[model samples]
Target: MRHLSDADVEALLPPPAEALRLVHDALVALSRGEAEVPPKPTVHAPGGAFANAMPAAYPARNLLGCKWISIFPDNPSQGLPTVSGLMVVNDGRTGAPRAVMSAGALTAARTAAVSGACIAALAATGAPAGFTGAGLQARSHLRVLEALGHLDVTVYARRADARAQLMAWAEEHVPRVRLRVTDDAREAVLGRPVVVTGLSIGLTGAELDPSWIATDALVLPLDYASSVGPALARASVLAADHVPQFEAVRVAGTLGEYPATTTWTGSLLDQARPDGRIVCQNLGNGLSDLVVAAAVADAAEAQGAGHPVDTGSA
Candidate 1:
């Protein structure tokens, strides 16, 4: 087995546009039933922390994989990353495992890719964008948003330091785009054509006023139920990576108080798409991880980013 660190995956994965394209194709394949996405089974810990298993098979990409990740919200206070995980890729033809690699970088890259694809497909170009919680997801969204050629952005976060840091990073990395920091989340989010927020998952999350959303803006709430309140979810046209996952959970009576949603059935490329204030709160699909991890595994095979371990030693 070959092992790839997060750095290796980063160096090997393609640029943002190419990354977005790859994941977009995977999602299309998913909607067409060419992929298998198992429900993510999360093991809950105390203090709202969790670890989950995400397994997927991307036959179109000729790979199967599983990513095991842990999200401990309190880790940051302990001077550590909040999310950490690894992915295992297998040969599509055979059941043999191929590679194991850190998934931190892969997660961010593919998420940005998926969010970018959503924005490109649903959002209008050259319009203002806003980000309501500045962090990794915010940065990832910005990277792909820049790739989409829409750069005028307003950022809002409770922490002034985080907002300032993101603005500085954008100025240095995406100088062509204009960046503004705002103190009011309502001011930053309400009227923007594109809004991205990373408030994360929680049961007691503060309720949001849905009227803040523009009539036609595309809101990508990467954080699941936290950023988007139930009011917005019930009001907007909803989209998700995999409806079956949520459906299964809902059927099992585990989706407590989750707003009503219908799974999106059409292709990601379909011309007749959802209109009005659209919300994408995709329950994270494992197939996307397999598709992206497979790419890094292929690159690792070619560039020798990781070393092969002798099976006999195991």
Candidate 2:
């Protein structure tokens, strides 16, 4: 087997334009019912940590993979990343594991790519956008917005240090964006036509007022009820990366008090109205992760990247 480290995955990843295209195609395939994504299964650990297994099979692409990732909220306190895991890609014909690779960078990139796809499919580019909760996801979103198209953005974070870090990284990586950092969320969401938030799933204790959103803004909340409120999701012209996944969560009670219903996928981009809230709530499907990781693995193998392993089990 071949093992791809985070660095190898990063090096093998395609350029932003191509990455966006790959993610876009994956999402469209999901919308067209060409992918098989089972409901995610989670195993809770101590101290509010959990490991989630997200498996997806794409028949059209002849790819099948799974990402077994964990979120340990306290890892950062120990100078470790909050999220870490690995993705395993299998041969579609024989179902043998072809590669095992790191998933942190892949997760961040694919999340932003999905948002970028939604933006290109539904919103206009070159306008001012807003961002809330600056962090790794925020950085990915910023890079993606510039990659898929150019847009000036204003970012607001609860922590000044986080905001500063994002600014510095933007200066180094995505310098084209005219980024404005603020201390509060209002500056990020008010009057902006497109907003990308760094809200993690299941977050609570703070709520963003619905009135703060622009009348015709497209709210791209990558998280669940954590960042974008349930009330906000219901009132808006809702869209999801996976309709069945959203339904699964709703049925499993993860949606809480939100009135869950069928959401607009990419296919309805042209029909999406601007008069109300245009919300893209991506609960994130395993299929998206599988496809992106598989691409990285395939490319890495072709280019003679990553560490090769013996056939014996470790």
Candidate 3:
């Protein structure tokens, strides 16, 4: 078996354009019933922390993998990342583990790549975008947006240090993209052609107002309804990356009062862009992780990255 660390996974990630293409293909396959991805099952911990087991199989792409990831909202208080875990890539024919790699970077990459796919399919380019969180997911999204040619952006974060860190990172890594940091969430989201929310999930009293969204804007919420809220979600033409997963969460009350008119995001990709505000709540599908992880594993094998471990069975 090949063992890949977080650094290895990060180094082996596909380019932004290629990542976007992979995610796009995965979504299309999912919508067409070409992929098998069961809804992720979760185990809870104290203080609203939980971990999920996400598994998927895309035979058409020759991909099969499972990701075990945990999200602890209070990790930052202890100077730790909020999300962490690992993924195991398995041989499609034999169902034997082939590679194991860190999940943090892969999760962030696939999530943002999915959002990039949404932006390309639903929103117009060259317009200033807005983001409401400044964590790893937000930074990853910024990189993807930069690759998509959406260079001008506004970001709103509650912590001064976090905002400053994001600005500094952008200056060094995504230098072509200009960032405007703000303390006001309204300033970050209102009237933007594309707006993304990555706030901590399960927060009460969601603040964004539906009226602030433009009539023709694309809203991608990575934080469930934590930042976008029920009112804003209800006001838009809502969609999700996976309809069944979205419904599962809605039935579990994670998405409070979300409209029942939700459709599959991939279904809208090939159709004409719909009018009025659109909100595509991407709950992060396992199929995307599987596709990207398979790509990473293939690249690692080709480039002689990651150390090998004996599984004894083989």
Candidate 4:
């Protein structure tokens, strides 16, 4: 088996432009009935953290894979990453496990790719000032925005130090872009035409005041917190990878205070194609993980970045 580290995944994965294109194409194909992406299922252990299993296949790309991504947000309290896991790819033609890969990099890349795609799509409408948020996911959004050619950017976090770190990193790595740190989340979203929120809300998801947004701005909630929030349903368009995951949990009485529906995002996107303030909520579909994992794996192999593992020994 091939084992990819976060660094390896970074080196091998498609550049931001290519990655955005791939993700956008995947989304379009999904809308057009060319892919199978099941809703992600989560397993909550006795501990506070949870693990999720996502599986996806792209017939167009001949890629098949699953990603086992675990969220141990409390891990940071123990001086570890908040999220960690691995990706497993299989032979689409033959039923065989092809590789075991690092999940952190894959997750970040795919998540960023989604942001990049959204940025590009929104830019065609008219480029916004930029987006803001604080967290690893927020960093991913910033990276994606920069990659997708959004030059005016600002980030907001509760912590001054953390915001400073991100600002410094942005300056060093993506110089052409302007960066700012603010205490007001509303200030971040107010004038910007595009807003990406990537904060952890445990299993519940995060929420932002709709009033913070200008009329008809595009909001992308990468975190599941919005799953139960009124802002999600009240948005002009509510697009999600699967209505089943939330509906299932709601049926089971585990997902508290969220409405249940079979409303798929593809349908909503089709309905609200050209105009309106839209919100895309991702419950993190398996298809996204699978496609991204395969792309990263292929990139790693071509670039000779990952380590070959002797899975047989294990």
Each model's TM-score, in the order given?
Answer: 0.92, 0.92, 0.97, 0.87
The alpha-carbon deviation from the true structure for residue 73 of candidate 4, after best TM-score superposition, in angstroms, is 3.2
List clash counts for every candidate, in order: 0, 0, 0, 2
Candidate No. with top TM-score: 3
Judged by whole-model lDDT over C-alpha atoms, candidate 2 comes out at 0.78
lDDT of 2 by residue, 1-314 (tens): 68998888888776667777887878777777778887788888887678889999987778888999888767766977777899999888777788898998898888888887777877776757888777778888888888766568999888788888988999999989889999888877788889887755556765577888876778887656666787777778787788877777777776677766555465555354556668887877788788788888889789888888775653
Q: What's the true lDDT of residue 168 in model 3? A: 94
Writing each residue's lDDT as its tens digit, candidate 3 over 35-90 gives 99988898999998999999999886667889999989888889998889999999
> In angstroms, how far off is 139's CA in candidate 3?
1.4
RMSD to the true structure for each prediction, in A, is 2.1, 2.1, 1.3, 3.0
lDDT of 1 by residue, 192-297 (tens): 8888877645534534567888888888776666667667877878766777776765565444556656655226445566667888766667887787788888
Best by lDDT: 3
Candidate 3 regions off by >4 Å? Answer: none
**What are the clashing pairs of model 1?**
none
Ranking of all candidate structures by their TM-score, best first:
3, 2, 1, 4
**Comparing 1 and 4 on TM-score, the stronger one:** 1
User: Roughly what TM-score does model 3 have, to 2 decimal places?
Assistant: 0.97
